[model samples]
Target: MARTNPLQFVQQVRSEVGKVSWPTRREVMLTTVMVFIMASLTAVFFALVDMAIRGGLRGVLSLFG
Candidate 1:
C-alpha cells in the first residue's frame, strides 16, 4: 500500500478545486428560474391527478353504499 504525503495531498486538492468551472451569475439565475417553473408545473399536475383519484374513489364507494 503506497502512502501519500499529507503536504502533497493538500496541494493536489487545492489545484483540483481551482480547476473547477464556476457558473456566472446569469447562468445561475436562469437555472434557478427554470427549476422553479418546472417544480410549480409538477405540483399542479400532481394535485390535479390526486383530486381526480379521490373523486373516482368516492364515486365508487358511493355506488357500493
Candidate 2:
C-alpha cells in the first residue's frame, strides 16, 4: 500500500472535513426535541402496559387465595 506524508495526511483530512454539511443549530435542536418526545412516549406506553399486566396478575392471585 502507498503511504502519505504527514502534510499530505493533514491536507486530506481538512478536505474531507470541508465536504461535510453540518446541521444548523435549529435543525439540531428540533431533532433532539423529537427524539426526547418519542422516547418519553415510549416510556409512558411501556409503563401503562406494565401496570395492566401487574393488575391482571394481582387479580388472578387474589381469586385463588
> What's the lDDT for residue 19 in model 2?
100
Model number with the top TM-score: 2
Candidate 2 has its poorest 10 consecutive residues by lDDT at 1-10
Which pairs of residues have clashing backbones in candidate 1? none
- What is the alpha-carbon lDDT for the whole of candidate 1? 0.99
**What lDDT score belongs to each candidate, Candidate 1 first?**
0.99, 1.00
Q: How many pairs collide in each candidate, listed in order?
A: 0, 0
Regions of candidate 1 where Cα sits further than 4 Å from its true position: none
Candidate number with greatest lDDT: 2
Q: How many pairs of residues collide in model 1?
A: 0
